[model samples]
Target: MRLNSLYSELQWLPRAPEDFAARLKAAIGSSETDVGRALQRLANYALDLNRLSKLASAIDKAKSGGRSLQPLQPFRLAVLSNSTIDMIVPAMVATAARHGIALEVIQPSYDQVAQEALAPDSRVNSSQPDAVLFALDYRALPLKLSPGDAEAASATVEGGIAYLQTLRDNIKSNTHALCVFQNFVPPAEALFGSLDRAVKGTLRSLIGEINRRLADFVTESGDVLLDVNALAETVGLAEWHDTQLWNLAKFPFAVEFIPLYADHVARTLAAVRGKSRKVLILDLDNTIWGGIIGDDGLEGIQIAQGDPVGEAHLSLQRFALELRQRGVVLAVSSKNDEGIAREPFQKHPEMLLKLDHIAVFQANWEDKATNIRAIAEELSLGLDAMVLVDDNPAERGLVRELLPQVAVPELPDDPSWYARTLAAAGYFEAVTIAQEDLKRAGYYQDNARRASLRSSAGGVEAYLASLEMTITFQPFDATGRSRIVQLINKSNQYNLTTRRYTEPQVIAAETDPEVFTLQVRLADTFGDSGMISAIICRLSQPGEWEIDTWLMSCRVLGRRVEHMVLREILEHARANGIRRLTGTYLPTERNALVKDHYAKLGFVKTGEDDSGASRWELRVEDAWPAAAPMKVVSHGFARPKETLSV
Candidate 1:
């Protein structure tokens, strides 16, 4: 059968598990990219245990044959697992592979996690992976102490936390690998059962304390801790753990649920690679609410506690509200009269989401693809960062066909399943939630206000000046290291070198005397755009410096932020008696916006390499041009007392 035919069949083969397996195998055999797409399509279908098992086998087959599942950007992952992870490896690799992560997971010898992770000459440390997975379990913890022995239990908790911290410190100080640790899942048997929390020294309580300590550790260290406990609770304790498998292979979770667990890992790892979806565009009718607001009217619509159908929509609205709080920009793309669409948000008493909650509300008769594009333009984000959440398959298909860059999730047929379906999708996974994330909705709202102000100001320069923006440049410190690494990994459009660096790498660069590393934060009359840009340049010679990484957040684009960053670099170069500043434009599929970045900044092109990379340089002997329009301030570095031209 044709590849498209197989893809089409695998999407909705409800009754034919055998046929689904056969079709999936054929799809994988045909082409790697197409098969990846096919696997994504199949993710929408509710796969039975038999089908999932067969799919796992097919994934192993495809992986062993050298098919590149993650064609975009691959992550070098090493799992320093304490348990028998051999059974989980295939599904883990397959699930991650489906998500565009070339996940080559190296399973260190079972129970040898410390040796592999801490020792410099050990295989895992020697490989120097981009990220290391510390697949930990309850086995890492000691046996429960006496019920009243609170001191001993506390010591055990502290001991475990210290062990994790020491190992992480060793790895981090020695290598640039991100430590992805797994939070402990409480063992099934507890001394006090459900009442374990009533006493402090209980085993369950100790595990809980350990988990809490792990969270605190990650918060302080900027490491990643996966919440396997939450995953187990969501999947159900009865279904999550298999006694037979655990006894035989030390697998913490059931084999069938390994795929789901793998998906969780993949999403977390993908977030580290800058693959989280930023904007969530929701369709109004039957998606966020049960009935069409235009025809059903605000009161008549099904989005309240009294009706079952309405409650489903209410649950979905609640989920969306949480996402908004986490920095996901909520938007609306609906085929309805604009005035009528605003009624539900305005008048519905049971509506959890108010008008102010939505950053972009495009409720009109226009095509959804067009509306989505407008939303992207307004937010100054790429289509790839936007996710379309519509209940209608036709509408989803239209956006998927037209704006293939927008992620359109496969919605379940039943409206009641919408909330659960979207919850499980994990499209908005984030590695770190900075203070700036909590204020993102306000930032987007401020953007809208800026747009209105710009239209009235009559000129770009005048509008920018009217905002009275001030940008502060500070050296990367311990507190801001996580956000800096995030910007380095995620910022694409305005990036020059498109270089991604881990926290350790960034920390190393900060102390290097020959390197200048800075974090840029912007504020205006409207609000603060936190840590919007980063610059890393190394002294190439006695009189010259080379730009290693230059990137700015898309939210602060078109605001002359780049100009300010360049000016700061130039000032530092001039202050240190440097003669020339050199930079390169390394082309990438997403960073075309920066192709002429040097030219725009007055850096003349010196040469072009065989790989299409262009070299640019500027002689610092001449007076620099006028400073950037915004008020620029410097911190953590020496500034020239005299005026320096940019």
Candidate 2:
């Protein structure tokens, strides 16, 4: 099949890796056009031995020929493993290149993961990786226990885990890089064969117990965990590892599965760097359901029960519902009457997703690309954080062309494959799921209420007054750390400096006398906006403070919250004898919203850094606003001894 038509007609099913690789190489090298899309299609192929081999070969050729492939964003990746991993580097580079991550890997000596991670001078720490991945294996554990020696086996497991934990703690203490912990997979052989299932001292039981502890550590430490055991099971354990390779080359896992493994690691890295998507814009007719909603009508659409086609659509709805439950914002952008489009969701008894589940619904004759832009604007999210799903290839193609930043995954022609396609894309992956996540949909719903209020108010100032909004500032407490870290990491558009911090680092900053950390929560008469902002300030001198980090949730923008926060910061600084405050605005592709932030707050432009980041300074004597625009409440360390009540 022709390359353009192959993708245009959705005929690019998962081919044998070699067949797909050869086709992709030709398609990629033949044209200087749509090279990204061609690679994306190739990446969708199910990973296996042949596929990894062919993919590596294709990537090697592309590199050798200096093909016009899209340039990858550079990322420093440090991999410390007990097993030999030099062979995995090419595959890691290849898979990451496909995903737009130019991975520069740092490999430590075999079995020296802990040593390398703990050494302050080691390359693992010196490279300053975006993240450090520990590729641990069962070989790292001493498993020579005889039957009935359960106590000894348990001790060995405890000691090994303790040593691993110590290494992780050292890394956390020494560096700011995120840690990706890959748990060990149980070796296939059991000392007691099938009886290992019943024996606590068996090799299988010991490994399973170790993994259980590893999972607990991951949760408690707030580190990213790669369940290699789960991946091994998914690919079948026997196929995932090779004993001969382990003995000959110290390659613990099957070489063929390196691509898949790299995919998972790269995904987490992308999410950490704020490249992960948030909103899912879905199409209606033949996309969410088996037929056109406008033509098929509410009762006629095959969305529920009994028939195969109906089941497919039902599964898609259920999948979308699940994503919504996990805090993914769902919106509709279809070419149909808004009323007609919402009828099925309103009237259908069997509909798994109702109208209220959607954060936004824009169903009209307007082109989808424009409507999607509207959705992002309304939701206060960047287009890069959206994933558009549509069954119609034309719609997908148009959106892809118009908004290259938005992830437009190609849906399968068959309805039966819709849910599977979306799941396999892994566009949405969050490190931590908190209560804040579950309540996110409600917060957006409240945004709609606020929008309604804005339209009705007499003017912007009148609207701000009528809302009875209150801004409360609190110290960085444990109760709010998860959401705070999440906001620090995921927040892009409204962030100043755009400095990402992990939970441990944030916690460390909280107790430091030189650092002042505050969490901002806002509430209007409508509802609570949750913890909406965070600020980290460092004492540069006895009387001078520097704004280390300041980020606010996009949902609370345009409410003069920034003014309120700045006002309170000045008040607190004055009270504590801090004479001047210095702040920097680091320009990232996503943080343009805050370019004029310091200037608007009356901060003087001090100078610009080599990287073009602007620096500003505000004197405590700078006149405070004559009157507060909104009520401000301060608590904990952020609270001042005296303040204006309103």
Q: Local distance difference test, per candidate?
A: 0.78, 0.77
- Which residue pairs in candidate 1 have backbone atoms (N, alpha carbon, C) closer than 3 angstroms, thus clashing? 624-645, 624-646, 625-646
- Candidate 1, residues 1-646, lDDT tens digits: the string is 2322212122222223347766786767667566655554454344544555566566656667877553345677888777788767766655564455656677778789788767888878877888888888877656456566788888888888888887787777667898998887766666666778767778778788889988888877778879888887765666666878889878777776665677788889888877788898889889889888888887778988979998988988999999999888999999999999998898888999888988899998899999999999888788878988888888887887788667777766777767766767778898888788888877898888888888899988888888888888888887688789888888888899988888778888989999988898999999898889999989998999999999988777788887778777877888788889899999876788888988888889999988679999988876365565677767777652333222
lDDT of 2 by residue, 483-602 (tens): 898888889888888887767788888899888778999888888888999999999998999999999998988888888888778777887789999999998767899999989888
Residue 320, model 2: lDDT of: 86
The residue pairs in collision within model 2 are none
Whose lDDT is greatest here? 1
Off by over 4 Å in 1: 1-71, 401-404, 413-416, 639-646
Point out the worst 10-residue segment of candidate 2 by lDDT. 1-10
Candidate 2 stretches greater than 4 Å from native? 1-74, 97-101, 146-149, 189-195, 608-612, 626-629, 638-645
Quality of model 2 by C-alpha lDDT: 0.77
Span of 10 residues, lowest total lDDT, candidate 1: 3-12
